[model samples]
Target chain A: MRRQNLALVMTTVAAHGPLSRAAIAGRTGLTRAAVSSLVEELNTAGLLTELGSLPSGRAGRPGRALALSERGPAGLGLEVGVGHLGACVVDLRGEVRGWLRVAADNRNRPADEVLAELATVSRRAVTEAEGTGLRPVAAVLAVPGLVGEAPGTVATAPNLGWRDVAASGLCAQGLPLEVENEANLGALAELWHGTGTSDFIHVSAAEGIGAALVVGGRLFRGARGFAGELGHVPLCPDGPVCACGARGCLEQYAGEEAVLRQAGLAAGEDAVRRLASRAREGDRCALAALERAGEALGTALAGAVNLVDPEAVVLGGAYAELGDWLLPGMRRELTARALRRWPPKALLVSGLGRRGPLLGAGMAAIRRIIEDPAELTVSRSRR
Target chain B: MRRQNLALVMTTVAAHGPLSRAAIAGRTGLTRAAVSSLVEELNTAGLLTELGSLPSGRAGRPGRALALSERGPAGLGLEVGVGHLGACVVDLRGEVRGWLRVAADNRNRPADEVLAELATVSRRAVTEAEGTGLRPVAAVLAVPGLVGEAPGTVATAPNLGWRDVAASGLCAQGLPLEVENEANLGALAELWHGTGTSDFIHVSAAEGIGAALVVGGRLFRGARGFAGELGHVPLCPDGPVCACGARGCLEQYAGEEAVLRQAGLAAGEDAVRRLASRAREGDRCALAALERAGEALGTALAGAVNLVDPEAVVLGGAYAELGDWLLPGMRRELTARALRRWPPKALLVSGLGRRGPLLGAGMAAIRRIIEDPAELTVSRSRR
Candidate 1:
């Protein structure tokens, strides 16, 4: 119970910036004495630092404000896309300290080679922050496929050409690690920090459309921990064949590959972003491609509303930059096709976008540490 | 707390035949003393009656079995369809005591007139049970549309042509009454009394594909209480127009009207049953119509799996009797189109079938009484 309270206190502080002892007490509904005791213990553990004293409001002495200290530990977040891996070093308080990105297709590279490259980049990031006295407390990797119900293995990653890979084991060589789907992690980031805090669907529309469901402030991974495979549901009986050995999938029609192929782009994130920008600038070819993508997305989103009936739909990943041009058509389908009584609300572009996976990975590590404090020591390692 | 225990004990006894006190204790995880005390209190309340001595397992004194008293107050369940309403008087243990059906269209009849007809039928059913001295303790109405988030109003009933109609109030009339969607009630009945419980989508293939989402032993009504509006979602954008002003809804393609129009059957439950019988007898036209309906249903189910991803999809309502002819095509679509990593299991025909809504209404009343014991009262009026 005490540990639960401690976790809650730290999370509350993390959520709402710096706070005085009285403020924390009032917000958490904890007694002032209990708050003081917990805060004192946290300060002793190097998890919290006291800021300058606040001005006296009444005739008594001024109180000191407390905030998360950089001395506690830091988090390492990794996001593995189809052809790129991004990493970031964030403080225990969720503030990004350092970042790095490498472009390498996992499909062509061996798993061991990818891991070694990740290790090299991660080592560089650690060396870059050596003088700050910050330690990499935990690492979280966000991959792009359905992870199995059991934690260690990745069931399938069509884009990466990987199946049932021991992801956690590879990442957990000596450091504590957490692995999650990029879309699910994006959803977690949005649920805790973006518009759809209560319920929403976060779709990463890259090579394929990956989706995550956040219901009632919690990620709802269905039976077998493999829910939200939205891209694979058949939209057309005789439509084009999908890479998953299925035809007429939402991804086959609306994914980045489809958009790029249709627009004659290089099928890269930068190219996709450039197309969206050109479309925004009223380029005829780009406009037509984006409009077609939006229609397909609308049909898929209409299907989403039919099932989950969430409060809002969030679009991220490479194609989200298309923005309102994509949303209007989607909304039209939802209004025209969804249940009239409760059509889903407007779509919102993820503010975090590409950075969402990394931040979410950091959050996953923090959540792990808070949930099982015994793992905290395992996370603290000199790279 | 006492009422919860007593309700659990009574429900357990009702589900399984009359059980010994020790057996009840073993099943409920309640202490023997607490169970004994609850049993005593319930016996005093005349809800339970102590039967004669049970069979002695060994050479010890036989303990008396406790059973729900047949003389206890009864429950009233009503299923309000498009053009007809079915009423049933059931015992506290969910045993059907008497039944009645009324023919009237909510579209043509005034709201008050429909309510009056319902009241008249309810009064007659109550009188019919007078010989057994069973008086209704509560009533539940299962309407075929989206119910409101508010407790009393039916937000929209397209088939019934009622919007914001206070069906709950119409039945309450100074009595305990609860209103729910027919599909949701059907799912509940299947979950608790018919098929073994698991995640399933219970879709009523009626005038429209009214659906109920049952996950983790509870109905998941989405935000605004309109989760199962599957009928409104567009199956084909240009196939046919829906009465709800939407284009190519699943209803237009596979609903009762679609079946009736295709099979040239009268618009009634009997006609639906006759069509099912014809399909079973291998009538080419009937079989063809049902197959078409199944294909549309399969499309919707595939979409549903892509989104919510339940363990199984359960079919119920007016067209449930189509049986295997309607199932194979749907399964084919689901297997061929659903996410390969996490495809749902095969479809299951609801065991309750057409009678599910009736039983579900009773279950709703029972649920209400159990959730809020203060609502349960011993009426002074005789049956």
Candidate 2:
């Protein structure tokens, strides 16, 4: 009961904080005494901090406003993309205190070598965060693959040539770790910081395409946690054979490699960037390539929309970079194909872009502390 | 609090009943006095009945079991299909007390005329149910189109030539009426009585394909309540143009008319029945047509499965009748196209088949009473 009340108070402040004790009591229906006690415990834990006093309308002394502390336990986010590695630290206020990104050709590379590099990057981020007086409580790693039922395992990452890789133990030492699908993390980022809808679809692209569904404000992982394989949904039953042995998958048309190939560019780290610049310069081949990819994406999304009926579709990752060129064809195809009285209201480009997964990973870890502050308080007492 | 306890007792009996009063109290965490009082009120409301005594192993007299009533406040289910109209009554025990179905080519038919016929059919069903000592509380009409947000309105049912048709007022007068999409109801019926999985896709077909999603034991209606329009999902992309003005829709390849056309059969009320018989007899053209249609259905469903990742796919409505012919092609395409490590676990034919929509409509009405028996009891007191 105490833990529950603590969580209720913590969540109340996290959601609508910068509040006085009286205001929190009124909002939570807890007595002012209970709120004060809870707030005091939270303050001692470094999870809450007093800000400037609120101005009282009457002449009485004003109560200090309380908000989530920025110097307490933070979240260390790590990512292993097919072509890059990233690490970041986010505070309880959802602000990034440390950020680092490095490009690497990780496809089919040794998982150990790649993870060693990631460990160095994460250590640097943690060091930077600690220098700023922010303590990272846990680390979350986002991978472009199916996260296994077992903790910290990536079941498969076709683009990375990784299978059954246990990522946490080898990467961020001294912190408890959790592994998540990159697309799922991106969708969570969109939910928490971007469009903020309770229901929407978020699609991201890198070497391969990935999509995630957020229904009722929660990630809708299908029964076996393999939902949102939009890249592999067959677009042309007889077109091209894909790496997954499917014919004419959406990836064959819209994935980074496919778009680069169609634009007559050699596959490399800067290929998508070059293609985007060429499209921006009104190059016919680049524009046509992106246009075709967008149409294929829209067609597959039309099917997804028909099935799940989300409120909006947010383009993220590489697609966000290329959205200006992609949106026209996608909108045309979606408008032509959607079986609705009205087209879906919004097709958005994610502001978080490629950074969504790493930030979402950080937020996810911070969220755990906020949701159950008792864990931190109990562990602190034990220490 | 009293109303909640009353609903708890009612649902407990409905789920685990033929249970004794002592069992109800133990399961519900209510005192024996509380259980007895709530049971008495439910008994007076005709929502529950005393069953034969349980065979208690202990000494002394055995307790009488309780179950949902077989009479009173039943559900009246009505459906307007493309080629037929149906009405039936389901008791709280989920037994169909009365059944009626009439053939009518409702396509392009006047909404008023068709509703008049439905009213007659519903009246007969209600009368027959009353003859069997059952009193219907409300009627739910299942239509083959999108039900509007407003009460009693259908936004569009292309197959039925219905647009903004206020069906509740025109049919089943004197009874509180609710309108639902047929596909949605079919999926609900599957959830209640068929495959019984909380997460599955239910696909039904008549002249056009319709599908519904059930997530966490509730129907997942998209933002606009237009989530499942599988018929219009593009399958061939450049094939035939659909009535919805999209090219290569799944309906062009998998709908009844499409299959019948491919089989060199005339379009009529009995076309599907004839095609099924011919395929049963191993006719080459019939088998080929059904096989092609199944493949198309499978392709569309593959996209859905990839997007939603349901545990099973229940082939309801007309597809249930043709499961033997459809399952093979669907399995083949799904296996070939799904991006999962393993294909979806189950693809079962619905036991309810074409009757799913009507039975679901009836069950939906009955569920409202089960969820909140207070409304029934309170209204009964006023009466």
Which prediction has the highest DockQ against the true structure? 2
What stretches of model 2 exceed 4 Å from their correct place? A31-33, A55-62, A170-174, A341-345, B20-22, B29-34, B52-64, B170-174, B341-345, B380-383
**The candidate that achieves the highest TM-score relative to the unseen native structure:** 2
In the range B281-320, model 2's lDDT, one tens digit per residue, is: 9999999998998898888888888888988888999878
For model 2, how does the per-residue alpha-carbon lDDT over A1-383 read when each residue is reduced to its tens digit?
76888888889889998888888898999998999998998899889999999975568889899999999789888999887999999999889999999999899999999999998888898899999999988778999988877888889888899999988675545677889999999999989988777788899997889899998898998887888888888788888999988888889999999999899998876777899999989999999999999999888888777777778889997789999988888888888888764354578899998889999999998888898888778655887
lDDT of 1 by residue, B1-383 (tens): 66567678777777674888888998999988998987786676556788898995868878789887776666788877776778887776667888887766665556667877887777788788877877676788888777776776678777777788876655545666777888888889888787785788888865777788888888987655667777765676566778867677778878888877887677765778788778777888888888888887887777777777787888887656776678877777777767743334457888778888878887677566544333342223122
DockQ of predicted candidate 1? 0.49
lDDT (Cα atoms) of all candidates against the true structure: 0.74, 0.87
What lDDT is reached at residue B60 by model 2?
82
Error of 1 at B87 (Å): 1.6
Candidate 2 clashing pairs, residues 3+ apart or interchain? none
Cα distance off (Å), candidate 2, residue A97:
0.8
* Worst-scoring 10-residue span by lDDT in model 1 chain B: B374-383
